[model samples]
Structure formats: C-alpha cells, structure tokens
Target: VEMMENVSKYRYANVPNLDAQVVEIPYADGRLSMVMMLPNREGLHSLQTLFRDLSYSPLASTLASLRETELLLQIPKFSIESKLNLRPTLEALGIKDIFGFDANLSGILAGKSAQIGSVLHDAKIEVNEQGTVAAAVTGISVIPLMGSTMDTFRADRPFLFAIVDQSTGSMIFAGRVVQPTWAAPSPLG
Candidate 1:
C-alpha cells in the first residue's frame, strides 16, 4: 500500500473500442514495446479463451481505433514468478517423441539416446510506478484529454499484456493478470 501511494499518477484519454481497451508503451529506442490489453468487465472470459489464437487481429484492430479520452492510470505495483510444465501441453499438440523413450537424438550425441526429461518455462515480471522492471526498452505515450468531460481507465482488475520486439513485431512475453500482486501472482500474469 505504501508503494502504491507514491506511484506517479497520470490522467489521459481512455478510449473504449470493441471488447477491450489498449495502451502501447514503446521502448526508448523504438525496437521493443509493451502493450496492455484491458478487457471490458463482461468480456474477461471471452478474452482469456481467445488469447491463445496467435493472430491477435482483434486486439490490433481495437488499438488502431483508439481515440484518446480521460484516464486515471494507476496500475498496481506487482511482481510475478511462474513456471509452466510444457510436456503435457506439447504432447497434446502432437509433439511427442522428444519426451518419450523412443526419442532419437543420436546425431548430436553419437552413442547416447537423449530424450527430454522435462520442459519447464520460468518467467518473472515486475510493474510499478517507475515502469515495468524488464530487461528491455519500452516507450509510453500520454494522450491529453480533448474536452472537459473525460472517462477513466483504471487497471484494477484482470488484464492482458505483452512485451514485443518492435523491429520484428514478435512477442517476447505475454500473459494475463487475473490477480495482480507481489506474493501471489497469477500464472496468467
């Protein structure tokens, strides 16, 4: 709570598009970026279900249509550490032998049969008032409010995000924040 109190708050335009609202923060050199996707209160479930479809066209479209509005940005400060066991998920996708006894990796190791014992993916992220605690460049934009009346975009609930390489437009990291926190970060985060 003390950390949250000192966060540098900003008021900008918060445009609402189709299913979710978005904000893109580019890296200092424009070679990397972070994109935040906050879904409508009612669209959370649908967004989660659709996130796995590599072609995030719907998300792209919504971002391209942003029109800036009033926003009270106060994303809570949090850190996440997670591990994912990919053996099961991979096998289900038809990637079997690598984790089975029948695996054949002899070319790399002449006489030894090398089979993957386990596949573990570990990731960590921290976001606070200063910015994302990541090992890359990312940029941010502040859109001024157009009129006296303004809308707010506060990320106090579940939201999705991605860290991408702008040069190649490849996602380096992606996940959701179902319950943003330091101690109990969600796997989605």
Candidate 2:
C-alpha cells in the first residue's frame, strides 16, 4: 500500500441513479484524465449494476453536468494486470460464429476462410497521490449531476476508475480496484 494525500480543484459529480460519486483528476497536460467512480455507501453492487446498464448517451449527459469544486482526495496506491479470453463471453452474447468453423471473415481477409483463434484482452492500471498512470493493450474496449461546496473523497473501499482522453472523449483504460495488494513478479520480468 502507498500513501495518497492531496487537495485540489477538480470536476466532480454525485449520481442518484447509481448512488455514487465520480471525480475526474487530470493528467499533466490536462487533455487526459482519470475518473474515479465510487459508491457513497458501502458495497459496489450498485455501481456494478449501473455499469451493466451503461450507454454512451446517458454517460455523456452525466459528464456534461459535473461541476468544479475544491476536493480533499485520498486514493490508495495500487497496480493490477488482467487478461481475458473473450470467446466465452462473446458466445454467451449470441456471437458464436467468430469462434466456430463456419465463421466467415473473408471481407477483411480477402476471401480466406477465417475464424478468430483467441480474443485476448490485457489491461493494467496504477494510481497514487499525484494522479493515475494506466494502460490497456490488445483491447478494444460515468456520471452524474451535482453542485456542491468543498468535497472530500477517499477511495479506501472498492471503486471503479478510468483513464480517458478528454480531448476526444475516448476512454483509454478502466478497471476496478477491489483491494490493493502487491503484484507477483511477471514471468517476463
């Protein structure tokens, strides 16, 4: 575990639908940022449910309403590396063809019969007192309305966070931090 202590002005909101608070912390240049969505009360089930029903339109509307305020923030320092094979999840969503023999991706492969072998996704995120540093690889893959005075946010419990390109309104990396622990040394390391 690492220490997190800071006080600054940031964009923030509290959503009634999700019963959570979201705080956006910008990176050095200000065009990119890390957004932390944390439940006001204990437990992440409500936040998880909100994510399941998430869509761009609702998210945009929520973000568009955030207000600026001075925040006293404390977020734990943590790091995580996760990899997922999307085949099963995709199949469950009625996308079975891509992983089967009958699949046809010829349009992109120029008539060569092809099917996906393994859809691998890897993601990583790290956060500390200064800001957040995060990255996600091999993956293709908010909100609220509120106006308040000085705010205090402490991410000592489970929370979901994201790194985004503010200029393009594009998400670069996102993950949940349920518990902070030291990561085992990577095989490559």
Clashes of each: 8, 0
List lDDT for all candidates, in order.
0.56, 0.66
State, as a TM-score between 0 and 1, how close model 2 is to the true structure: 0.65
Candidate No. with top lDDT: 2
For residues 1-189, could you state the per-residue lDDT of candidate 2 as single tens digits? 553545556788786765778888777677888888887866667557656645523555556767887665566777789899988888889998888899888887986988898888988766643335222111111112266445777776778777778877777887787764333211100
TM for candidate 1 is 0.62
Give the distance in Å from residue 128's predicted Cα in candidate 2 to where it truly belongs: 2.8
- Taking every candidate in turn, the Cα RMSD to the unseen true structure, in Å, is 6.9, 9.2
The segments of candidate 1 whose C-alpha lies over 4 angstroms from its true place after superposition are 1-17, 40-57, 66-72, 129-152, 180-189
- Assess candidate 1 and give its lDDT: 0.56
